[model samples]
Structures are given as structure tokens and as C-alpha cells.
Target: MEPLIISTRPGVRHHQLDPVGPGLTGRVFAIPLPTTPLLTDALPYVDWSDAYAVLTPLGAPCRDPQEWAEAIFQGPALWVRALFGVRELVVRLVGIEPGGGHAFATVNWRRDEVLVGTDQRHLGFRASVLVEPGRVALSTVVQVRNRRGRGYFALVRRIHPWVVRSMLARASRTMAGPS
Candidate 1:
């Protein structure tokens, strides 16, 4: 399916994907961080943010926000998992805890959202998965603390959106089962 891309502003784009199947369509939005209370409190100053949304069928296996977060972050995407491992190792070397282990356990769960974050000398980041009736949105906000953080995220931001889109798509397909 062809994706419709719209640039809302500098460093922000909205991507709308054609539905692959009934209730299986998805979108990856590189928009500004939302001004919701939870998000604002989570990361006050956002140097970068993006959100990925996927349509969910009723009775989907991973309908809950926390479940969706686990499926997306810890699901059976071997290459993505490897990348996460490398990120963990690199961050640890810089005195940052990368929130290793089960994704669900590492995050903070609220009523309809699951939040995960880490702060270090270089940078700090917060990510959230919000579950609605028939949609799940995964959003991430990052704050660059210094020049090193700026340089590091500059490299990461190039690939971050693609990685998020891939993980969300894979998780949605896995949870949705065969068509």
C-alpha cells in the first residue's frame, strides 16, 4: 500500500498508510509532542518526539497499553531486539541504565498508558503507549542535555522513526494473527 506523507513543519511529518487488511492499517506521525498532562509532566522540555498509531481489532490479544508496549518493545523482532541490546550496552558504558529486562516490568503503568524513561548526564527520554478503544499510540519524547546528547540524538533521530514504525507494524501483525 502506498503511504501518504505530509510535512506539517520543519522536522515533522505525518504518514498515513493504506489499510493492509480490515482494521490493520497504521500511521507513523513525526509530530510535536502532545500537550497532554501526562506527557508534559513526563518530559517537560522535548527536543524531539514522534508517535506511531495502529488500528486494533476488537478482542485483539494485545489490546491493553502495557501489553501493546511489551509486544512492540519486546516482541519477536530479532534484529530490533539486537539493536536494543547494543543501545543498552552503549548507554550503560556512559553511566545510564537502559531499562533492560521485560518491557512491562521496566515501565510505569497507568490506567490506559504505559510509560518508560531514563535520565543521564547526556540526555533523557520518555516513551509512552496509550491505548484507546480501537487504536494504540506509541509516543516518545527526548531531551538533549548537552552537546554530546545533541550529537548522539542527531544520529539516532535519523533512524528512530523507521525503527518505531517497524516495531509497531510487526507487533500489530503478530497480535492480529492471520488477516
Candidate 2:
């Protein structure tokens, strides 16, 4: 499989929501899998821990939906701690509810996209899939919501592209199984 790339423009599936500034968004052309199954079943199988380890020098992986909920609300503290060996304060914890064919959560209740964070920082991380005749188009969009977010974004911006790509690749490989 080829590498997934992040785009400056919103992905085709990501356009369901209007743009809010130049939020980081991108898509990957997978080997054409069913979008529904990919989201509900296959996505969870992606080796997120390993991927994060490689991508950001962090050990935290969103292993499950509940864990994802916690991680999101807590921001990148867990990953930061794993990388730096120091624990940061938990700024806030938001509630996660079922909606829009995906789990939705928010901090500061800003519009355009959904993510977890406090007033000082807001992040949007969403995953969706669009299936074509033979392959699946996987996409995600990330948005930052505060001044604190700016600093965080600056650090991750360079690697954000690879982060998405590796995540998609891991998920695809998991769906495909051992070669």
C-alpha cells in the first residue's frame, strides 16, 4: 500500500462540516475496503500504540473507544508523559456521546469540528471513510482551538502528516492481516 498524505484542503468526506480556518485535514487511498466496516470494526484494530510510539516518541495508544474518550479529554498529556517521563496536569475531561455515525465530544463548544480539550486548547480529531467501487477512502481532519493549541500544533505540525499516514497504514495492514 502507498503512504497516506495530509491535505491543506478538506477531504471529500470531511466537507460535511464547513471549514474553520485552515484546520489540518487529509485522506489516504486504501486498497478499497468497505467504509462502514472500516470505521466500526477495522479501525479499532490499528496498532495505535505502536504507531504513536513511532510517530511521536510516545507510548500512549488509543486502544479502545473508552480510552480514546479519556485520552481526548486529557489532551496529549499521557503521550507527553510517556515521552518525557513527567506527568502533566489533567486540564479537563469532557463527556462522549453517540451521534452522527461517530462518537462526538467537544470542549468550549466551538463549531466546525469535534475534539477534546480545555479553554486554553481545543483539538479536532475525526475519522471517516468513503467507499468507492473498489477501494475505501479513509480521511481525518484535525483543528486547533486556542493559543495553547498553537504551540502544540507548532510542535506536531511537521510530523502530523506522517502521523496520519502511519495510522492509516497500520489500520490497513491490520485489516489485511499478515502478508
Superposition error at 81 for model 1 (Å)? 2.1
lDDT tens digits, residues 46-105, model 2?
Answer: 211111111111222213333323333233333433432221222222322212312233
Q: What TM-score should be assigned to candidate 2? A: 0.35
lDDT of 1 by residue, 25-87 (tens): 564443333445566577556666666677777665445666677778777478877787788
TM-score of each: 0.71, 0.35
How much lDDT does each candidate structure score? Answer: 0.66, 0.32
List pairs with backbone clashes in candidate 1: none
Candidate 2 contains a number of clashing pairs equal to: 2
Q: What residue runs in model 1 are displaced by over 4 Å at the alpha carbon?
A: 1-33, 58-62, 88-107, 177-179
lDDT of 2 at 178: 28
Candidate 2, poorest ten consecutive residues by summed lDDT: 48-57
